[model samples]
Target: MFREANSTLVDREWRIAEVCQRLEHDLEVLGVTAIEDRLQDGVPETIYTLRKAGINFWMLTGDKQNTAIQIALSCNFISPEPKGQLLLIDGKTEEEVGRSLERVLLTMRTTASEPKDVAFVIDGWALEIALKHYWKAFTELAILSRTAICCRVTPSQKAQLVQILKSCDYRTLAIGDGGNDVRMIQQADIGVGISGREGLQAARAADYSIGRFRFLRRLILVHGRYSYNRTAFLSQYSFYKSLLICFIQIFFSFISGVSGTSLFNSVSLMAYNVFYTSIPVLVSVLDKDLSEETVMQHPQILFYCQAGRLLNPSTFAGWFGRSLFHAVVVFVISIHAYAFEKSEMEEVGMVALSGCIWLQAFVVTLETNSFTILQHLAIWGNLIAFYVINWIVCAIPSSGMYTIMFRLCGQPSYWLTILLMVAAGMGPILAIKYFRYTYRPSKINTLQQAERLGGPISVSREYRATTTTDRERSCSIINHSTEEQKPSLRTSSFRFS
Candidate 1:
């Protein structure tokens, strides 16, 4: 009865946090209960795969240091082997924490020249001191360590850590499943929440919510990668098709005495962009460079996505160059095909437009990796619609395009000119693609080939063997790129699964 009364008094004093906290600790332990929350299925394998994909992980928890370390090991966040050393940074005061941080930094530097499997473990008390007094040194240490565990940390500290990583220009993904995690979830670039025993607060606050943690593997490697690839292709191709027409116009201006006479009728230009070219590229959103099973098995391919290999300056330049070349081919071929004949300017415009449509179609065909039935219908149906629409428009005797399609379709040279444009535009692209696939095949390229042949992709083991190297190289690239910025050193971006 006396103990119950004391507990009630303590609860009532909760408004005074310091007094309430002191009373909470002073209470006697009448009994102890233990509950085991085992790791979910596939958690370890998923973590392993993500790590191989060049992602760093940091575990922030309110659990005791020993308990957190145990959980980290059980979940494969850190290795069990001797080589995977655990460095601890803990102290009660500012001076002690600073000295410990310097010592850890020294050790990290000594091993920086070689590959080492090391993870740092820090408790909340020392973390608070280190972050407040030695933020730069602590940030450097965090950058060097691939995995870290911060135990006994409060919700505010979790958010602060996320902010620190972001301030360094690193992308952060925070995952949590409790009310205490709300701040951290809201603070990150990408927040994922698990809908489980911890309740719905985190899920409500996060950008994405999942039933289990293991689903993260698919979320990032499969959907995330597909989204990036499709966006890049869509954006770049939009530019390519637009530029293809504009380049032809610029070249035509030089020959047309620079009087700004439009090569294509305004209606034709509108239809080309809105109806003729839009659907095919839109369908490209469904494209995949490799199969889901293949990507899941060989996560090392994620290096390409992490390193910005697909959507970089070099790729944009290639697309720009391709567009310029195709425009030149279409314009030069159409003009030369009717050089001797007394063709109408509208006829020349129709011929050139035809070549652009066909060339763009084949260009999309060349880029598509996985084509669905819907994609098939969109591409071919759009092509057919181009002619049927033009034919209908040309039927209107009052329209500028009157008899244009009919006049061009009757001539065999018109068809030959289109064929030449397609052949010339596609020829170089195909050759370069073939050479790259045959001689310098990337992991994704190899998977694409195997998928095409309906053969077994047994390269998982081979890829696993090189995952360490790929991860190191990815980190090296990020670190080297950010080496110059000291006060606000941009660090490697991290994605948490």
Candidate 2:
């Protein structure tokens, strides 16, 4: 056993492949049918791809090192020449990728050209973030490193590897067709899951998944280069823009309140809340949406950075424009209503404003993934809560002092106002996204599968994945597939990249 490239899944795999080839090859030669079948089934696609690419590959399965080489040779995945490029990695034992990360960091001194803020994924396998600033220190640490796959790795180590890669300013995409790849898949820039007997976690975490790993070649070579920075920018920009619109409405709302008259009859505060706030958020969510799995997979710092991108000219302009538009429209309509006593036309103006603001908001995130997933949840949650609170304050007509402060009169206009508000609120978001991602009870449960597959529920604590009879039961997913398979491959489809 020598060194692991970087990722633990690969690390563990190196060992497993070693044992499988050694034991299975000998057993097969001895005519053991079951062992032969297992070895064939366990053959992972990674080895084949690397072989095709003419990259170096090896494993020190406990079988004779020559036998290990022989198995690789039989697969047509090994070079005929015994060049120094081929080194045997002992797969039976788990080994640390580095001795001390602090020491590694010391080697990577921050510099103007190679910033310390960035992290790099060394050798594409280990879970360590080597600061570019400290490359020298990292080199020193490397000098004293142990071979990977001394046998097992923790999930935290997997996450650390991703963080390190990000720091290096490299977009690392992870691919796995089995349960072993779940943690790494969740950490990569993009994860390509392949459906296999290993289970659904890989498929669920991945940006794309296929029945076979070969399809992943297309995704990595193609869309992997697509820039998400723009998408991220627009997403945060849309959210800021919505808030700006609300602020404009609020300012005008205050003016009206102070003057004891409506400042803008273009749209009522309630109408604005419905369309400008609620509808924009919902539609933007659906139209600009990405998989929730994606959001969860990334580090929170990535979102913060993306949100910062919203500070740019285009983003700021969009936000300012929408907010200013609301303020102007409301102010203009209020003056008109005052002179003409056109309060009766509040409905018309409200409807028009709703159509405009909602559409704008929906289009805003069309550049970003519905402004990222967790954000969608927050925006929708806030918007819906706004409506519920509005109704609670305005609709009830109690015959008490309590209702005196909160409830509006039971007039036909007020009832109609509420209905119009609903229409306006729902209009814009719906305009852009005709199709959306939907979840059904019939889908298979990956969490349950993870628990059943002997996966650690809490890796940091200890191994309890398959400790007892409490292990979860096996079940089938009635109907579910990749996010791409859903109606929304991309609705608004906005990305800065």
Candidate 3:
């Protein structure tokens, strides 16, 4: 083969034939060479966790079908039960591939009555045929099967699969530990790289990297879920805080005769972002509300991610309405209580600024459920910093801007105005909270109602008509807040009367 390459530059066929001929007779097996690649510790448990989390696992590898099947079995990607069926599809021609795929699709359609778990295994060549000629049928089979594994796939094919799923509007996550997986990882919505013997090429390209595959469970269930929730809350809260400030300024503008001057001093404005409001959000981002044991015990919490129950348009609107209400209360109460002299624009501005800052901090504090020592420090530290900055800015020389604009700092009335503003701004919010907590339906009573009706019940006619027992099992997960025994799966209609 080497001589032919150097001399005639043989074609691929001749090269392959020559290599096979040489290996056929001269290569005597001195000993059977065995290489075993053991599964990473906790991989099986992780797979089980992901499965319960409603995440589908697909194995795309360059290995032979049988080897892939063995690996899949060992990793618990495929259940070991005898009821499970592995459908392998491969052929020398496109026609043969089409027939095999049709058979799998037929089995899937008929299997609901028999209730047999089925997995589909397809090779690169067969996948190419299915994708080109029988795309719709193949997609149906992929969706219907309990699990799907694609063997002998090139890197491009892996990328293609990820792209296909993404095109279907699925939030795909591709995790791999090798150079060959870079394209697929990059193609996914979130890419996770596993740091193992395979290489760092994939890790370098991924959004997150982990030392072991098992950590993926925590990365998705705990960190991913929490991160999403925190980010949503942070986004809405940040908007609300800014909107409150802007609305206060807008309200002051009417009295100031359309003057474009800022209601708060420059130092106070800077402190708002840098000192007053930074820590609450920082603490919020790191807060872990649900315990690891709680999350692991109820894997259905994972389904909430798909439904986007945490942050949506309704939540954003609610935040905006709340902010508008608080802004109105702070503006109206501060002006009515403290703006006795129309000539004292500076005093009014001071009261408004202080009121806004205090109310903003108060609202942030309200959102916090349970606080660690550090979080408590962060929240209190922001308030202390605001006061210290306020005093320092007021103590500056007469030529200084703060000294000129904010002259009400030493007045006891100024502080009293701020105290009244806090009470006024927080009154309605506290009332709403207290009312909800006091009048909220008991979870125990709701569960009793559900049991009385039957299994999980939905009042919406559409939901009742569409929902099946299997779907109820899949959708029902832990409700993070309520102590009810039933899964807190969201329904289209209100569950309680």
**Which candidate number maximizes TM-score?**
1
Q: What is the lDDT for 146 in model 1? A: 71
What TM-score against the true fold does each predicted structure earn? 0.87, 0.37, 0.78
Native-vs-model 2 lDDT? Answer: 0.38
Rank candidates by lDDT, best first.
Answer: 1, 3, 2
Candidate 1: which stretches are off by over 4 Å?
A: 1-32, 460-497
lDDT of residue 55 for candidate 3: 68
Per-residue lDDT of candidate 3, residues 1-497 (tens digit): 65554366448667767766776876767899665555556767877877777766677777778877877787677878999888888887988998999888888888845656578889999999888988888776655654777888888888887766655445677777767778888888788776555557878998998876667778888888788778888999989888988888898789878888877766667667777787777887767655565566555565555556568778799889988888888788777876765635555666776777788778877876556888877877877876777767666676144553345655677778788878877888898877765687333223334445566632221111122222311210000011112223211100000
lDDT minimum window of 10 residues, candidate 3: 475-484
Q: Roughly what TM-score does model 1 have, to 2 decimal places?
A: 0.87
**Alpha-carbon deviation at 435 in model 2, angstroms:** 32
Q: For candidate 2, lDDT tens digit of each residue in 340-413?
A: 54433333333334334443444443444435565565455544554455455434445112232123333454
Of 2 and 3, the candidate ranking higher by lDDT: 3
Clashes in model 3: which pairs?
A: none
Runs with alpha carbons beyond 4 Å of true place in candidate 2: 1-136, 139-160, 167-172, 178-183, 186-192, 197-209, 217-241, 244-247, 250-317, 333-497
lDDT of 1 by residue, 1-497 (tens): 33454557545444355555656886788999766545656768888888887777888777778877877787788899988878889899999999888988998888865667788888999999999899999888867777788888888988888887776655677877777778888888888876655568878998998876678889988998899899999999999999999999999999989999988888789899999999999999999998899889888777777666778889999899999999999999988887448788888888889899998899898899988999999898998999999999999989988888998889888887888888898999899999998999887887888888899886643343344333322221000000111223211111242
